[model samples]
Target: MKKGRNELLAEEEKILAPYAVSSRNSGSRAYEEPEHPYRLPFQRDKDRIIHSHAFKRLEYKTQVFVYSEGDHFRNRLTHTLEVAGISKTISKVLGLNEDLSETIALAHDLGHSPFGHAGQEALAELMKDKGGFEHNKQSLRVVQKLERRYPDFPGLNLCEETLLGIMKHGGGYETTQLLEVRRTLGPSLEALVVDVSDEITYSAHDTEDGLESGLLKLEDVKQLSIWKRIESSLPNSEKKSDLHSHSISRSIGRVLLNLMVSDLVDTTHQTLSKHKIESRESIAKAYQNKIKLVHFSEEFQKEFTELKQYLFQNLYRHPEVSRMSERGKETIYLLFKHFETHPESIPESYRKREGEDGRMRIICDYIAGMTDRYAIEKLKREGILWFPY
Candidate 1:
């Protein structure tokens, strides 16, 4: 027999923790529609996110490396998938809503600019006075206004809980356009799981990419506390001295992921118990009282922070990475300048909204939606960037 939506909701009630946001309690969508006969609300949201045009563009958007850098490096799409995977694992083990966690993870980076943080910084500087550019806010805007999939709504019209999870992932909820999302309460446990999963995925995967690209030396990486701990844990037979770089990088990535996830799950369980967060209402109450119930322990946190700092110094700031970052920023700046002076060059869809949203914002929206290759190709095609003979 096929399990209907009611059956799934029942199963969630039985299986998920009391604090987990079940489909039955999911907040209403901005625009109400009949529920699916077989799919849960969060499951539907995950599907909607996967099908969105902006989600597809993530494939060419940067994570730590540009699309042209290489095929093997992690791009925004791969990074999002990894976050979703990790979030689901953490949420399931903790008896939280895995579907909601995965949905939030999938949508977290939808607003990221084409060239990763470099592109975001460029856009931020360009629009500093024009309300500024933050990827999290932009991501909310993308789901709430920019996407035009439905005839009746401007955006995806995602469930209110899903939207809240997205808005609260990176911490600030005061600026959210959703009136129903309470700023007093912190994000749900599912959302918190997604947030931590994002950190874990990036810190580990970026290191792997850096090592694989030879931007980070094995010797330098081995000096980090987290790496040292991981190395010491490995048996002598598995720790071959002359393993290939790719093999070594993969091994390090797998171990790092396991360490972070295991620590987070165990510590979070202890946190939930300490705070007495037995019900959804108590979760909100705990947040109102400023209790953080989802995080790594103090000891593991210091080690993880050290790993991030090392990556920031050695991998993210490497000369080659910086050169590409600068080039990407320059591309965005030049394109924005050209479009500002010549609004006619922008697409008709964006141009049509100039009166209501203003010209600068419209321009930002258009550029923010572009893929790295699209932006670069457009620049070359316009003769803004000349090719040497």
Candidate 2:
């Protein structure tokens, strides 16, 4: 006997917290369709995100290091997977809907440009007079209008809840495009969990990648209070070799993950108790009142901020990273300017579609969707690489 969607919904109602957004309670999509018989709405949304063209493109997208730099560094795809994994873990511990959390985590970065933040900055600067480029807004656009998957709908036509979660996760650029999702003040618990998980992942994994790439030295990290604490906790006999350095980074990641998750759960539970938030409606009211329920403790927040500042000063701003970023920015800028003058080279779907912002936005979409290799190839194809500007 097969357990159907109804059974799954029933199980979710029994297990999920009163404030969790269950599949059964999901809002309708723009173009309404019959619910799936075999799977919940969130589950179907998750599957849709996994199969989308944008998801596959993430493989060649940058996460600090471009694909040509090294195969070992984390691409957008791996980073998304890591965020999903951590989000699900935290969601499970907090009694939230794991499917919803995982779905949002997976789709959170779908709007990132080819060369990561550097590429995004370039695009944003180019379109500064226009609507401007924001990855979070672009993410919303990907699901809402860009993806042409269905006959009845232009985009994926995902559940409203799933769309909202993706838009609110990570607290990035906000969008007013969707009137339905516009009023939300804070994200749901599941989305909040994903956001924190995203923070945990990059703060730790980027450090690991930096160390592995020789851009960041082990001695430099030891000066940070958090790293010192994590390093000292290791066994005294552990020799300080490459393996030792790797272990220290991993330990720092693990310790920070555990510490943040624990504090978040505890703080959230306390807030929920203090406010007596027993239902979805009450949770919404809490958010409307500007109360952020999911959060690390005050002590941990300071430490995390300090760690981020240290990383920004040392790792992210290192000369090697900065140089690569500059190259990436220049690459995106040239590709965009080339396509602007040569619109025929742009693809049909992106070009033909009557977007809200017109040709410039359409061009922006085409460039934003490109992978690192694709962008580089496009630049080379136009013979733009030969110029020594």
Candidate 3:
């Protein structure tokens, strides 16, 4: 087949088309028809993500603390940027669609709550009996029904491929399970890349953040059994594993970058060799690289557990935080109650079929959409929605 300008430039290697996509923005596709010159597949991916209302909320979402006393550390916004950066590098090296990876990575955390996972836990508790709340699902909601930049209804209506990639990221286990269930599973290759990229970036980046915060060091991390094995087998593991807090971020970043490029590129090449015209053969998509290996270390495993325990104790479940969180739940409840009493407050667009349950659901959706600061401010203005004395 003669390669067009938009076609992948591979001679012996069978080039994989960017996965099939239908964005939420245009509600079908943001990409220009193949005949159009201006829009491309990847560009559509970028546009859909950028246009998402959920994507915008990410600016205020938490990577760690929703309202950290300090300016340092990665908030969800910065973290998304970092994920996009690393994902793009992986895509570039492996000849994947950089825009698709970038959009998927950036949008991955779109549904995170104000106080990080703590707030999410609280919300989930409230909604456990209901359909339940996972940031990942919320992200899908945001993109599909929240963002309104375009004249189109709600979500960005991003490409199907981008949507699939987002859905599959984070070992959502949808793939492994689906494959197991039917004995045959096929997920978009972009989804697999984003998932692995997330693991790789967060593992190193979180450790880097811990080191920066004076809570951990390379030695502390090496305490992990997984890190130990990866360190032993991977070249220059000893040199890369440094305890020095200050210069180590740069070093660790380099090591992670090297590890990702090596595996993704090699696996991609291998996949290409076996590619048939019917479907694109995907890379192994396993975390056997140095990053994954190091993650399984025993000492590190204990620390990983400890880190969660520490965050819950010191940050998430603290009395002061809990007080605020409880108030958050109550406030959401009251605000929702008001909407039930006065359906006029909600936009007609959000109003679904009429009923008490439907009205309350809208109220919940509104409250859920709020940023921490915005939620607080909204409550304060509305006669101080705080916990009862």
Candidate 4:
């Protein structure tokens, strides 16, 4: 017998924890529609995100290294996949809703500007007076109003929970933001898992990328206590040679991921116990305090903070990475400026929204949707990124 959506919902009820967000209890979308025959709301949301054009653009989007840097390095798409994987792992172990967590993780970086953070910073500076260019907000915009796939709806028509996760991605949001999700109450446990997974995936993978690129060395990362702890967890024979950088980096990432996941699960369980939160209503009430229930222990937090800071200074700020960032920023500035002067170059779809949302925002939306290669090519095509001399 082929199980249907109702069967899956029943299974979740039996399997998931009291605190988990069940599909049966999922909030309505902005525009309601009949539910799918086979997929739950969050599961359908995950599939919608996976099929979106913006999600595909992530393949050409920068992660830490530029598209021109190398083929093996992590692109935005790869990073998102890793985040999704980690989020699912954490959520499953914590007895949370894996579908919602995976959806949030996959969609978290869908609106990241081309050239990674450098491009974001450039766009932010350009839009500072106009509005702002935070990727989290941009992500919400992408799903809510930018994407045009359905005839009945303008956007993906994702469930409210998925939207909440995308909006509250990076740890903070103003009360004025995403009022639909009721900001007075904090984000769900699934959203929190995605947030932490984003941090964990990037920190470990970026270190691996830096080491692989020769921008950072084994000795360099080993200075951080977190890295040392990870290194110490490995078997003695695995420490034979530094030439095995790739394997060593993978080991380092795995160890750190395990430590973080283990701690997060333990801490979350303890928090639930302490607060006596044994039901969905209790979890919702607990969220009113705006305290994060998913987090590392104090000792782990201190060590991870030190490790993150070390990566920022050593890996992210390496001369090679900085040089790429500078070039990327220049490209973003020039492109935004050119498009500003020649609004006619804007696509008809974007132009249609200009009257309603303003030209700058439409332009930002268009640029934010571009991949790294597309942005570079567009600039070069316009003769703005090069000179005949």
Candidate 5:
């Protein structure tokens, strides 16, 4: 049986590029690891994402609340897991690479800061002269340069396809500062599914999380005509204030899943019938529109703008989170300053692996990836990293 068609499968000549992160996949795939017992190529990618310190810090990073008063709120880690799960489920149903899908989903949020975007925004503002920072770019930082367990490498050394998916997030053929999803990757087959899955997962989940966190209400959705149109286009569901977010998420998930399944299946069937192959072009056309409609809806833009403002004004810019943000920026900047001043203090392993360029970027990458709580802990234990001589 054939592994389902994707961008990689569409190439006329099967010229496999050398991927730093090898495939950790299972039975029936021709492109899986060759007799490597410790892991499959995809498994390695998934494991790298799971074991990284960035993944652990996600527990404290924001999904909605900056530093929500509750334990059950969906932190960045849980959110990533949810997105990964959704992406994996869809990828599997569509016969795409589940590990790669999960890899992209899990690592997507690694670059986000302690207070989520608020902390991220503050940091970006502080460092505006230094090329600025974006969370998606930071996720790339995590994979390529942050995790230090392997004695040398900075990142998890992920595969090219996974990297492209991480970069593109299913938007356009060009890279932009606005959304990590807009970056251009050469092929559509592999990139489309992973990127769309991220949108399908996060849009539904964030809306649910926002409502659950008391930041949004059904009334908010009900207030807008266009949103109402989109909502009416989706399935119906009962609303509970406390459970509104998850319920909306569930309702929306069903709609999204049905859309993806129907589109992929219809496209695949049509491709098989017409061209005697699973049609990447057909599925690409069908799924590409989803990026514009479901992911980039004006209704979503208005709500997210509101939410971003609310979080900054209330939750993130709130006194508590503000204190944490100050300390976070201090920790990041000071840590970088420390490395800048005393390059000798840098870990010998990291130093040996990377020269000056590696030394400089690695510190920023590591500190920027930390959550508010984790950064505070590091600060407390290590004290201010910078030493002015």
Candidate 6:
């Protein structure tokens, strides 16, 4: 006999840690619907996010490089998948809710514009007066109001726990105003796991992408404290001359990911123990008192921070990357201006709802949903630019 939803819920209650958020205790959705016969709430949420149009659009969106940069580079969708994988590993190790963590990881970047941070910056400047645009807020908006998948509801109508995890992961000031969460308490352990997993995935993978692109050299990065630490930990035979070769960049990325994940898991266990956080309520109390329950040790954190700083100085700020960023910003600015001046050019579905959502916001939403290729093609169609970069 196959297990049903009740059986799965019972398993979660028995197997998950005391601090984990079980499906039975998950709060109601914005719009109520009958529960599935075999799928748990968080599991259903994961499926819903996976099938959303916004999620699909991530494939063509930028991560560190534009879509045209190369086929091997990580796009937003790939990065999201990596975050989900790492978060699930950490959550399972910590006995937290892996399903909720994975769902939050998958949805975290849905609101990012076409060209990564550069595109988001352009939109933020354009929407400054209308109400500043941040990707996290846009992500919430995407799930809550923008997506039109169901006849009975406007958006995905995700369970409140999933929604709360998404909102809390961003740690924006606006989270305070939401009545469902208390201002003093931090998010669930599942959310914290996803947040750290995101950091780990991006830092490690961006380094690999930078090395692969030839924008960052192995010699320069190997001098970083984190790299040296990872190097020292390798087996004696594996630490031979070939380890320093550029060909080992992928190997380095793998080792760095393992080191970080191991450090985080062990350190978090110690944190929970130190704070006496054996139950969900105790975890909340610890957070209310400003204790961090999920993080690396102080020594590891310093090394990780140094690694990020080195990447920022050497890779993310490379002339090639800056050039790409400038081009992306220009493209976003042109698209926003053109659409604002000619709202009729927008699809009939969006144009029809302009009065309800406001013209500027409607335009923003339309542009935000575009893939990098789509935005570039649209610009070419409008004769805004003659040549593609």
| The candidate that achieves the highest TM-score relative to the unseen native structure | 1
How many pairs of residues collide in model 4? 0
lDDT of 4 at 116: 92
Give the per-residue lDDT digits (tens) of candidate 2, residues 1-389: 78987787897889898888888777788898988888888888999899999999999999988888888889999999999998998888778899999999989999899989998899989989987988987988898888888888888998878887877534345445454353553567888788788888898788778777777777777776666556655555443546545665565566666666777788878888889887777877887888878887787778778888977888778888888889888888888888888888888887786365588899999999999888888877877763321
All predictions: root-mean-square deviation over Cα? 1.9, 2.5, 7.3, 2.2, 8.4, 1.9
Which residue pairs overlap in candidate 4's backbone? Answer: none
lDDT of 1 by residue, 48-80 (tens): 999999999999998988888899999999999
Give TM-scores for every candidate, taking all chains together and pairing residue i with residue i.
0.96, 0.93, 0.67, 0.95, 0.62, 0.95
Q: Residue 388 in candidate 5 has what lDDT? A: 19
Best by lDDT: 1
Per-residue lDDT tens digits for candidate 4, residues 1-389, read: 99998898898888788888889877788897998898899988988889999999999999989888889999999999999999999889888999999999989998899989999999899999888889988888788888888999988999877887787634334455456455554678888889899998898888777777778887867777776677678767567856546877777767777888888789878887888877766766888766567888888899889989988898788888898898888888888889999998888999988889899988899899999888888877887755211
Better of 3 and 6 by TM-score: 6
Tens-digit lDDT track of model 3 for 1-389: 75643443232124334332222111234433333344555565577677666667777655654444346766777778878887777666655556667888878887776656656776666666665667776676666556666664446756655665666424233343323422222334455567666765665566556656665546655554435434544446445555574665555545655554455556554544444212332222222221221122344446445544544454445565566566555655555566667767666766753463465455556656767667666655665445432
Minimum summed lDDT over a 10-residue window in model 2 is located at 171-180
Which structure is stronger by lDDT: 1 or 6? 1
Give residue 249's error in model 3 in angstroms.
4.9
Q: Tell me the spans in candidate 4 whose CA falls farther than 4 Å from its real position.
A: 169-180, 387-389
Better of 3 and 6 by lDDT: 6
Better of 3 and 4 by TM-score: 4
Off by over 4 Å in 5: 1-39, 151-154, 169-190, 225-355, 358-363, 378-389
C-alpha lDDT values of all predictions: 0.88, 0.81, 0.56, 0.84, 0.55, 0.86
